[model samples]
Every structure is written in structure tokens, then in C-alpha cells.
Target: MEGTRRTTLVLLLLACLLFLSLLATANSQLRTDFYKDTCPNVESLVRSAVANKFQQTFATASGTLRLFFHDCFVRGCDASVLLFSPSGKAEKDHPDDLSLAGDAFDTVIKAKAAVDSDPNCRNKVSCADILALATRDVVALSGGPSYAVELGRRDGRISTIAGVQHSLPHPDFSLDKLNTMFTSHGLTQTDMVALSGAHTIGFSHCKAFSKRIYNFSPENPIDPTLDRSYAFQLRTMCPINVDPNIAVGMDPTSPRTFDNAYFKNLRQSKGLFISDQILFNDARSRATVDLFASNNAAFNEAFVAAITKLGRVGVKTGNEGEIRRNCAAIN
Candidate 1:
């Protein structure tokens, strides 16, 4: 067993090195000022539009934030997730992608329009860049820390339903599975914990976590890791045969704010999913969860770093990809 453990560690280390190399290459091509000459006002345009959408519906903040994550995780922040196909054959048509907030797509489309409306910025900014900027804007608007977003990503032309399989983490994943997925993206354990903090502003449909409350196992029925009170509360809101589409805040408290409350919730066993509660239940990640739960500043700093690295994954800069005139369709 000890020898197997050593082998796993060695393999994980090698994978981390390989992913780090890819991230280094991608980050080299991305810069905060890539749009300076072509579209100096791109940030402001996206921020204003995102703020308006946030005002119209608080869903905008969580939706857009989730959209950024889904896009990046699936196709490396190229905005391929934004593509639409009337025949329902695109990535957006995938079952996993369908749970994404519809408002998020509208948020990007509107922000793209706002950016192009500027005569000087017309069709000059990539939808990928606009999505990046809008993501930061939503976090800030939702009371999260504001951070710099590196730009210059070009829109990807391919977005197929087949691309989503095994590309993103599932709600039922354990700590080891979460770490493996995140480490493959060149993220550390700290980065995975911090990025998970985005749940601070998001909602999860009942179906995503129903098993924890309803039928975790024949023996327990309810997950023993879940707080009894919280489990009952969840059951009340999502009884058997309830519409799976019915949603609940991921962070029951301060769901609209982008804050460290997510960590705190996990500490209380109020985490909405097995993957979430696992951070506290598993000794390997419990300390990080404790620290983030106790220190908001630490959480914010780590979150910024993790998200910045996330933006660098699989990027296409320079002449590698086209600046899409329509985010839903490749140019």
C-alpha cells in the first residue's frame, strides 16, 4: 500500500509539471493590455453591461461567473461554450452544459454588443476576452474582490457536445477526484479550495445534490457528513418528486455575495454537495477549509490567484484564432 501511494504521488507530480508547462506557454501570450491599442475601452464596456445585467437579475452574477468556469474548464476559456446550434448539437446542448444559467449567455451576448457598439472597439475584441472581463465585473459587482483579467484570447470555432464528457468535475466527486481534476489544470490544492469558493454566489439545482439528502445509501438514507438540521432543511425544500429544476442557493447564507461564506458553510456541514462537504470531512483538505473559513482575506487572495491561472488554460492568442463577429457562431 505504501509503495502504491508513492507511485500515485510521483505520477501526480509529473502531471503537475506537464500542466504547468502548458500554463506557462499560454500565460506568455495573454496580457492585461492586449486590447489597449485595438479596444482601449473594452473593460469599461463589458463592466457597464454586466452591471446592468446584474441589476436586472442577481442571477447575472452567479450565472456569468459559472459560465466563465464552465467555458474555461471545457475548452480553456475560448468562449466555445457560447456557440449555439439550432439543431442542438453544440456544447451548450450537452446535458451538463444545460444546467448553466441562460442569463449567462445573454450576459455575454449583451456585453459583446456593448463592446462592439464602441466605434473604436468594433469587432476588435474577442468574445473570449469579453467573457473574461465580464466575469471579473460580475464578481466585483457581487461584492467580491476586484482583480485584473488578462485578455487577448481568441474565440474557438469548435464546441461539440462530445467535448464535455469527463471534462468537468461532478458534484459527487471526492477530495481525491477534485484534486486530480484541479491539479491537471496546473492548480494546487489551495487553488482548488479557493476556486471552489465561487460557490459563494451560485445556485445548484436540486437534482445535483439530491442523493445526499434522499438516498445516499440504503443504510443511512442521509449522508452522515451533512449537518442534520441542514439536511432536513434541504429535504423540506426539495422533497421527493419535487421538480428537479427547483433551485437553492449553494451558500444558504449570503448567497448573493461573493465571499468566504462558502468555506464557513462547509465547516458547519452545510455544504450543498458531497464534493463540497468532502473538503471538511477529508483530513487532507480540512485544514485549508478551516483557514479559509476563518480568514476572508486569505480566501480572497487565493481566489484571485487561482482564477487568474484558470484564465490561462488552453488560450489561443496571436494569429491562432479568429475574433468572432458572433459569439454564438464562429467567424
Candidate 2:
């Protein structure tokens, strides 16, 4: 009888250990209320900071959104994109990120400051979490659906220009290239289409899309796929010798609002970037684009889902990274 009791006790101990292991794994992942106890006001503080910036300029919405995208694509959503290396070799210093607006970085800095204002929250919130919340706020403030952002992501310490160039999908990426890039991050083609909807609220520099408007090829001076009138407007806005710094809205119609119009523009061959228009050009993604163009609700739902998945990419947690004292520099 004593021998039987010893065996039963060992079994019970093993079961308890297994349960604790599972619990730890689950807790290590992101959660909706990770900061509820540590920084209860994190969400409100981020929202107010983003709102103040948005009130200053509507461009803040697109800027912050773009910042989040760049941050995630390079090294996950670790806020490494905000880091400033002494050698000027950080992710944001990459050629592709040169176009990332200053307003976006400023918005994050402001949001971080606001969060740290609370004594209980000072340096307690991770820049990564602040960025996620700011991104959600930007979308909601710009007439898009607001989704709950999962928290508990720690800040990454590494940011390299080479990583940005290798990881980010460029404006000139083909549909296949875009798919491959997104797929590497565990995002599906449908998610790529939905996330592309973010183009509805942003602007592009002439240098980024001028080839589409003029001298696309030796045989076809202009891209034949581009709409005639739309091409003409782009040509005017981005003349062959025009200053590269000049910018044009990605969505000419209601560019300030975040909506499904980007997909609609893709259907009409009015997409501003080759990457944006290629969704409709490819057979695999075209149907998804059409569906989103026709249904705003569906597009918004997919976008929320995709962005949430994006926030989970390469997350740092459970002693994996630090909560930096300053977002732009590592402690």
C-alpha cells in the first residue's frame, strides 16, 4: 500500500509540473490586458498623445501607421525602427525607410512621454507596446475600425539597415514577391491584400512611382496597365524631371480617410504603387481585392485581423528584450 501511494504521488507531481509549464507558455505570449495592472492608463495615454498629434496634422495618422509597419517588418514590433545608431546604419536609415515621415517618429516619442507621465507607468511600458497602441489609435482616429492591441512585447535592441532592405517589400515589388515576403512572416495572401488597404490614407513621393507614369519600358513609355487618365494625372504630378521630394496622395479620392477605397482603386487600375496595383493583377489575390472593394465591413475585419497577426511577428517577451529608457537609444 505504501509503494502504491508513492507512485501516485509522483504521478500527481508530474501532472502539476506539466500544467505549470503550459501556463507559463500561454502567459509568455501576448495578451489584451497584459498592462492592466502594470500600467492601467497605457491605452488612454497613447490615444490622447496620438489624438493631439492628429489634431496638429492629419498626416500623423499615415505616418504612425507606416512607422508601425516598418518597425514590424524589420525586426518585428520591437520598436527597433526608432533606434538611432551612431554610424547612421539603423533600419530607419535604410534607403527604403528614407521616405518614412518624421511625423511618425515624433508621434511615438510623444506617446511614450505621455505614458511615462504617470508615476506608476514611468519607464514601465515598452516602446513596442506603445507603438502597437499608437498604431491602433491612428487607424481608429482616421475613420478605420479600432481593434484591441495585444501587449507584453519587449523592445528589441538590434536595428540594421541591411535587415530592412532584406525584409521590407518595396513599392516596386511584384505580387509574387510581395506574397513571398508576407508569407515568410506567416501572413497569407488575403492578409497582404487587407493590409495594403492602408495605402488609402498615405502619400507617396514622386521618386517612388515616377517610373509607372513615365518611361516604364522601351516599348511602352508609360505602363499600359495604368489607367489612361490616372496615368496622365500622375505624370502631371510627377514629371520626368520633377523634384523627387514632391509627394502625391496614394488615394486621390478621400486620401485623408482610412477606407476600402485603396482596393477599389486597385480594381480601377488607379493604384499608385506597382506593389499596390499588383494585388489586382495577380489571379490569386484579385478576388480578395474585389471582395474587399465591394464590402467595407469585410475589408475592415480582415485588416484588423491581419494587423493583429502582424503585431505578433517576432515578438520579444519573458526576458528576451529590455524596456528601454529612451525609444531612440538603447540603455
Which prediction has the highest TM-score against the true structure?
A: 1
Q: TM-score for all predictions?
A: 0.93, 0.91
Q: State the number of backbone clashes in model 1.
A: 0
For 235-287, candidate 1 gives per-residue lDDT tens digits of: 99998899978999999899989989999999889999899889989999999
TM-score for predicted model 2 compared with the true structure: 0.91
Q: Write the per-residue lDDT of candidate 2 for residues 1-331, one digit (tens) a residue.
A: 9999999999999998996675456345899999889899899999999999999998899988999998988888899999998999999899989889999999999999999999999998999999899999999999999999989989999998888867888888998899899988778999988998999999888988888878899998778888989999888888888887898999988899999999888889998888988899888889999999999999999999999989988788878789988999998
Candidate 2, residue 202: how far the Cα is off, in Å: 1.2
Model 1, poorest ten-residue lDDT window? 19-28
Error of 1 at 309 (Å): 0.2
**Looking at candidate 2, what is the lDDT of residue 258?**
92
